[model samples]
Target: MAETVFATLTTELVHTRAWPSGHELETVVFSPIKGFCGPRRRHGRLGNVSPDAYEKTRHESLTHS
Candidate 1:
């Protein structure tokens, strides 16, 4: 799992021009699980999220130019 995340980070770094913020995703992205085992940087930092709320956040980020 750690290797996969590092590989993804490497790939994203290689495409820094396309994703200047390095926050792009290739799938219907879900909010990082918000429980005890959530994402590292976002640990316990977000409120609960549903599919619709996640989509809305994604949409906002994608269009916040």
Candidate 2:
């Protein structure tokens, strides 16, 4: 997983004519990491859906019961 993500990021960064400054680069790198580690990240254990989507679906099911 990490290798795949790194490869994709590397490919993207290589194509860019301009890169972010030091501080901005930090933000750019961590933002996606943060999202990938948070509730919004897709989970294979959750049938490949994001945690937010899984929660919303579960909630709706309970509410409609």
Please state the error at residue 4 of candidate 2 in Å.
Answer: 13
| Highest-TM-score candidate | 2
Instruction: List model 2 lDDT by residue over 1-65, tens digit each.
Output: 98998898778864464665667766787888787776787889999888889999999999999
Residue-wise C-alpha lDDT for candidate 1, range 6-46, written one tens digit per residue = 68866764555454343454321233433323433332234
All candidates' TM-scores?
0.26, 0.45
Q: For model 2, give the 10-residue run with minimal summed lDDT.
A: 13-22
What is the C-alpha local distance difference test score of each model?
A: 0.52, 0.80
Q: Can you list the residue pairs that collide in candidate 1?
A: none
Clashes of each: 0, 0
Return the TM-score for candidate 2, rounded to 2 decimals: 0.45
